[model samples]
Target: MIRFENVSVTYDGAAEATVQGVDFEVPEGELVLLVGPSGVGKSTVLGAVSGLVPHFTGGTLRGRVTVAGRDTRTHKPRELADVVGTVGQDPLSHFVTDTVEDELAYGMESLGLAPDVMRRRVEETLDLLGLADLRDRPISTLSGGQQQRVAIGSVLTPHPRVLVLDEPTSALDPAAAEEVLAVLQRLVHDLGTTVLMAEHRLERVVQYADQVALLPSPGAAPVLGTPADIMAVSPVYPPVVDLGRLAGWAPLPLTVRDARRRAGDLRERLGGQDGTPEVSVVTTAPPQPEAPPTSRLRLRRKARSAPTTAPPAEVHALAVRRERVQALRHVDLTVAPGETIALMGRNGAGKSTLLSALVGLVEPAAGSVRVGGAVPHRTAPPELVRRVGLVPQEPRDLLYADTVAAECAAADRDAGAAPGTCRALVTELLPGVTDDIHPRDLSEGQRLALALAVVLAARPPLLLLDEPTRGLDYAAKARLVAVLRGLAAQGHAIVLATHDVELAAELVHRVVLLADGEVIADGPTADVVVASPSFAPQVTKILAPQKWLTVAQVREALA
Candidate 1:
């Protein structure tokens, strides 16, 4: 069991506490979800449980934090290794050996377990995670979802009583995220391993969690309860739950499958199954949102800018090498200047790898990459930085400034952008909290805004974002869409790699589905997402399973 009593943490070179005076418990075998906007101290909480907070992050933590009856402060990671297994947002953080088998065996080996014990555990994990086929594969070659599975496999081999994961699926596609979530569910349900996770994509995990601990927006306390208890109050509840509220269900449905059973009744009661869908739960067909528009920034494309470069937009196939992993597979791809393209695939599908390759942060193993007729590798680092701005899945990784204003200033300066222009842009992206003391201190949603604000400061012609809504609440996601719509309107080519089908459906002109370093489907967003039949489903796409991505689009169709 893991416990936190009035625990709060602050890091070095950081201004504020990530979590404050939060009391919680994770009994053996129970799955607990820690969710809030980005940087709500969720990650910090996980880190504390695993002894990474003070040991690795060098933070000043107050109150008591214990794991399995052991004081975390008294035990370092090495000491807690056998008792608890941990995985971070970035799977690359813990990878040691190159092969999947070696990775799985790494932990057991460290503990000096017998070869037989290690072998049996490794084999069990391989089968459990559905990684038996990839056991011989190189760690560098696995997709993000695959790598994350391997990470879990490696830890599970140790048979730790408790497991903590920090946004493990942030970089995965919806299907891939589903795959990982399924594995996690099995671990918690079948194996009786206690699971504590911090995730931004609550739609996928909320139902699976036995307990949901919601950290209020910055300056507030965390509210703890069952998933149903949190759904009604959480700004991050999925559409079905929102619809459940509209349908007047006493308690909201937690999972899509459960919601579907009663959904038909609500629809029938509202009107009929034949003519335009009924509206018992919500007033409109698409179910207009109760969230205030002010919580989000909604902007439609004003006009498409005509670029000097004519048709036959450049196709650059670049290579990327991150540490030991050659992330990009030297794949061929092209982007039309005015078109919005989405990079899709399972996690570690190399979507981010490919994007980084285009920017030259990821050195390619082979093939050439060019952006706007300029070779990315040959271009100056600063020039490449300005050519493309990437909003990584982990917002905190991108933020490091005294205030929101200062962060924006640094981005502008780095991009050689005009002074104060970046600050002006922050107003819309940040909205009400633009003037906040420290962007870091805001709620998870606000922090994401600040991070995206900095990335936009570069004002790059090509925008590359990785899961832009990783930790956002409902309001924050709408605001992000507005920002992207505004950028696309200006003819800024945007390529966002995400698992957010709803955001993609509304913002992307086209969706490029990738699997195993290959483009399996590439075309209009509606065609790609709605066309899938065998693949696992996403919430936004599930309820309607239509071509539309937003409530507005559904309403338009009904009208």
Candidate 2:
């Protein structure tokens, strides 16, 4: 069992305790969920358990923490290495080896395990995590989801008594997230591994969690309860769950099938004329009127540009040749004037690679990419700035200026943009303490937001983002959705590669799934996400697969 007794931990050079008064316990083999907004001490709780809090982070800890009946303070991370396994939010941070297979064996080898034992454990872990095929693949070639799975597998190879993960699915597509979650579920249920994880995408995980430990931001006591009880009070919830709550559904179905069964009567009562299941569409208080429908501006908030009805003109995007990485397999894809396309797949699935190839950052070995009728590399530097923009998965690449104000200014200046326009954009988008503080000093979540804001300031016709909301808080995430929706409505061709299935269902029209550098599936977001091969649909979809995308869309479609 693991226990945090009124724990409050403060890091050196930091102003406050990342986690404060966290009190919780995980009984043996119980799957526990530690959830909260980013930077709210969720990771800190994991640190306490793994002995990274005071041992490595140099924090002032005020409470006791015990794991497996042993106080964590007395045991360093190395001492607890064999007993407690932890995978952090950033998979790259934990990786030390050069290849996938070697990384798996690194831990076991260090523990002086026999070669046979190490080989058998590595093979078992690879198969268990669906990574057997990629055993020979380089770590750098895997998708973000695959890398995260590898991180989990690397830890699990030791068979630790307790396993802790920090937002393991935040970087994966819906299908990949489901794959990882399914493995974790099996571990806890079949293998009896004590599992504790903190994740922002609650819809996919809440149902499987045996215990819910919610820390509602700092300065609050952690709220502990069963999944049902926690869902009743959580401020954040998936769209269907929220709808169920408002509609007064009993026991509040966690999956779509359950909701469908419970909602039949409600649907009938709403009155049906056509064959549609009949849900209501409240036309009242419509969101801000549709923005202009032109690719030069917003993408989603606007209707498809009238001229875009003509078949989209295809343009070549990227070309690359590398020693061992076949990043793109002579791929050809087109983006209509205002389409929102989500790139989904496991990590190293070439989602990030495809985005890079499009942006001219990573050259494809076999084919080339283009944007707005011109090759990305062939386009003039400043011209390329306006035609396409990219936000790399690593937010640091987007950051450069000392202060947030300066960062926005630099981005605006990049495309030979106007100061008034840039200032206007910065003021409206950032519009907070970001104006004065050093951009680099902010947390990863804050940096990501600022970077996105910077990208927006450039006003590119095509916007590409890789896991934009990886570290965002709930409110911030909602704001991001609003921004992207506004962009799409305004006429920008927005292409996002994300693991956030629920978000894609809310915002996108189509999805393209890549595996092993090949396009496995490409079609309407609704059609594909509903029955994605890698993952069953989100609970909302399971509740109502026909309405697989968003609650508003589902409700409207049913009506």
TM-scores, each model vs. reference: 0.79, 0.84
lDDT of 2: 0.69
Predictions in order: lDDT = 0.68, 0.69
Runs of candidate 2 exceeding 4 Å displacement: 269-325, 346-348, 366-368, 379-383, 400-444, 515-524, 527-548, 554-559
Residue 76's lDDT within candidate 1 is 93
Task: Give per-residue CA lDDT, model 2, range 373-430, as digits (tens).
Answer: 5565565444445466787777777676687777666665553456655455544444
* Model 1 alpha-carbon miss at residue 222, Å: 2.3
User: In terms of lDDT, which candidate is strongest?
Assistant: 2
Steric clash count of candidate 1: 14
Count clashing residue pairs per candidate: 14, 39
Q: Candidate 2: lDDT of 369? A: 65
Candidate 1 Cα misplacement greater than 4 A, ranges: 10-17, 133-143, 265-307, 311-313, 316-334, 348-350, 353-370, 373-387, 390-407, 424-451, 471-473, 534-548, 552-559
